[model samples]
Target: MTDISTSDVQHLAQLSSLQLDDHEVEALRVDLGNILGYIDQLSELNTEGVEPTYQVTDLQNVWRDDVIDNYDLGRDELLALAPDADSNQIKVPKVL
Candidate 1:
């Protein structure tokens, strides 16, 4: 069994910025310990010369052709509906 304790779980929660009650912390400790134990057991397996699998799905080039969407909208007509405008142009406060 993993040597995980309630204090360890509390410390982990603190590090992760999680707020947990005493009961929640206790449950998390047991759950996390089980997970850690499982990982430790897997680590004992001989993986020498075994190919590491990054993803199970086959790799493919899923791409789309580049295209321009040209909508001929008049600049003056669009600018006219603005809440504020200056000299045939839409004006807003400088962001920077």
Candidate 2:
């Protein structure tokens, strides 16, 4: 098991822009050491034949053909449904 010093915890807290109290610092010291020890245990596993995968779902880029439908609504009718319209186009509030 790895031992994390209080100074190491303080340095990590500083890098992460965290303000930890005395009790929190001691708690994190033990937590970080346990995390590193778990990682050390994982390193001992045999993974020589394992294939690297970016996603576990095994799905690739799926695409479909574009089809346009009028949906029984004309351009003028769609524009009229909008709360605001100008010059035969829908007017939306400016975001910027």
Best TM-score among the predictions, by candidate number: 1
Model 1 pairs whose backbones collide: none
Q: On residues 35-96, what C-alpha lDDT tens digit does candidate 2 reach at each position?
A: 89888987888999999778878678876568777878899998889999999988888979
Give Cα-based local distance difference scores for all models. Answer: 0.86, 0.91
1-96: candidate 1 lDDT, tens digit per residue? 587888899899999999999999988988888889888978778999999988777867767668755467777878889999989877899989
**Which portions of model 2 show Cα errors greater than 4 Å?**
61-96
Worst 10 residues of 1 by lDDT: 62-71
Listed in order, each prediction's TM-score against the native is: 0.50, 0.47
Native RMSD of candidate 2 (Å): 10.4
The TM-score of candidate 1 is 0.50
Provide the global lDDT of candidate 1 against the true structure. Answer: 0.86
What's the CA error at residue 26 for candidate 2, in Å?
Answer: 1.2
